[model samples]
Target: MQTQVRVRGARRWIMFGAIGFGALFLVVGLILAGVSVSFLANAERARGTVVALEWRNDHNGVSRKNRENDEPVAYPVVEFTSADGTQRSFRSSTGSNPPSYEEGERVEVLYRADSPEDARIKGFASLWLLPLIFGGIGLGIAGVGTVVALATRGRS
Candidate 1:
């Protein structure tokens, strides 16, 4: 009888943990989505050119396999003139292998008028990815937690 009671208690704890994690994810996802939307709403458009590719190494000085393939991630360095006519250069907030932008390539940019330095490549991937990814994961986690909690409640 003691062992049965302990098992039931453990199951309840597990259910609570799942629900807590799910709520956390959902809240974070909503926050991120809100931030993304706010950024998009107040951004100004600008024409910019990729001037260079900044390489970033994440190996922490540790030797690893395929050193050639492990070449640093390259983020584009963009130069643009703000609405006030001041020229500014900033590294892109996003990076990818094979590099999404090449040096000298013209690209559209979205920046906050108050802080042009906080600029981003204007596109679905760069702008919407964070919120979409987080929100999707949160929804999935919350759904799983709901299912687990319901199933365990019935057993209890």
Candidate 2:
């Protein structure tokens, strides 16, 4: 005799959750891919002067050698005013290879005037890299989840 498995409403919900996570991962992955491509495609256009720079480390992005004694590092926020007279702020993560400009400096920034809030500093490739990395992971997971769901469908 073979072992039997049944999927009730709750189990179905569990499956739904797994699939939902995969779907969400894919969606987010796509969005990140777009952003990454845009950034790469229009790197020159993303250039902007450094208007305001602030530190934001609510998530503690920095640390010392041990990563234990280091305090919560904040980010460097640079606000820029596009040619259209609109101002936007871009955050520089502590771990990023690029360094943020000092206050009232003319620094190059890569960003979409439409959503300047999501941008990276001129020297920072982290912004562009992150999306690709995240998208790859997301898409890969989504693919695996899809395959699993299909394989275990009615039998679930």
Candidate 3:
């Protein structure tokens, strides 16, 4: 009886963990999706003047194999002045493809002023991509949690 109780407790903990993870993912996804939508709606968006551009050797999986071959890859990046008249720097990401311009090139972008990291240099902030991925994971977790919770509730 004691062994059975311990096993049930462990299962209960697993269910709780699943629900927790699911809720977290869902919340984060919804927030990101909301931000992306808002950025898309803005008129002026994140228009800026490119002041600088450069590349650094920050290792990534895409370049991991090349790193072993002594390959020095140049990552395109841009620094620009926001509408607020403040200068900041942003590097390109896989999410935003086809970098718009080079250093000293004036460009228009749509990014969150407060969090420049959450930005789309060429277009609107497409935070939706991450959110959608997370949301799908959340749904999967939620479904599993629901099943476990249902299955364990009566027995415990």
Candidate 4:
């Protein structure tokens, strides 16, 4: 029947979509992981202090229950002395709703010799979280696609 044929086609499309999206995520995750690894390998480590927390309004429009009373996120500004004894500071790209660090807190910093201004606070959240999330989602999506494909093939 034409209806049965259309159903099969639709299922096939869904399977392909899942696999395609999964592969995309997997590739991105791999690339990000690679970059993180490279950075870690080449970066110079130093002790630093949290000098200040820069507050900014959440513009990403993540809805909160008390939208009008939304508090600003806090991004830490770290100050560190490079190997060559030059003073440097950089604001962290990641932020938290509740302040994650207090001013005067000591932390480890990772930076490149060439560009110490683009330094990062060395932590799992700063580096590994994104790649892990993407890779996990990719694997789950690809697994679902594989299951659907196998089921459809069996029915055929």
Q: Estimate each model's TM-score.
A: 0.85, 0.47, 0.57, 0.90
Give the clashing residue pairs of candidate 2, or none: 56-74, 56-75, 57-74
Model 3 Cα displacement at 54 (Å)? 5.1
Q: Every model's Cα RMSD, please?
A: 2.9, 6.5, 5.8, 2.4
lDDT of each model, Cα atoms only? 0.83, 0.59, 0.65, 0.91
Which lDDT tens digits does candidate 3 get at residues 1-156? 999889888988899999999988988888878866777676345555655444455556656666654433343455656667776666655322234455566666666666665555664333456778888889889889989899878776
Candidate 3 lDDT score relative to the true structure: 0.65
Better model by TM-score: candidate 2 vs candidate 4? 4
Ranking by lDDT: 4, 1, 3, 2
What lDDT is obtained when candidate 1 is compared to the true structure? Answer: 0.83
The stretch of ten residues in a row with the least summed lDDT in candidate 1 is 60-69
lDDT of each residue in 1-156, candidate 1, tens digit only: 999999888877876776777777778778977887899899988999999999887675677874656777889999999899999888887787878889999999889999988998887778777767777777777788789878877866
The candidate with the higher lDDT, 1 or 2, is 1
Worst 10 residues of 4 by lDDT: 60-69
True lDDT of residue 122, candidate 2 = 65
Q: Residue 117 in model 3: shift from native, Å?
A: 11
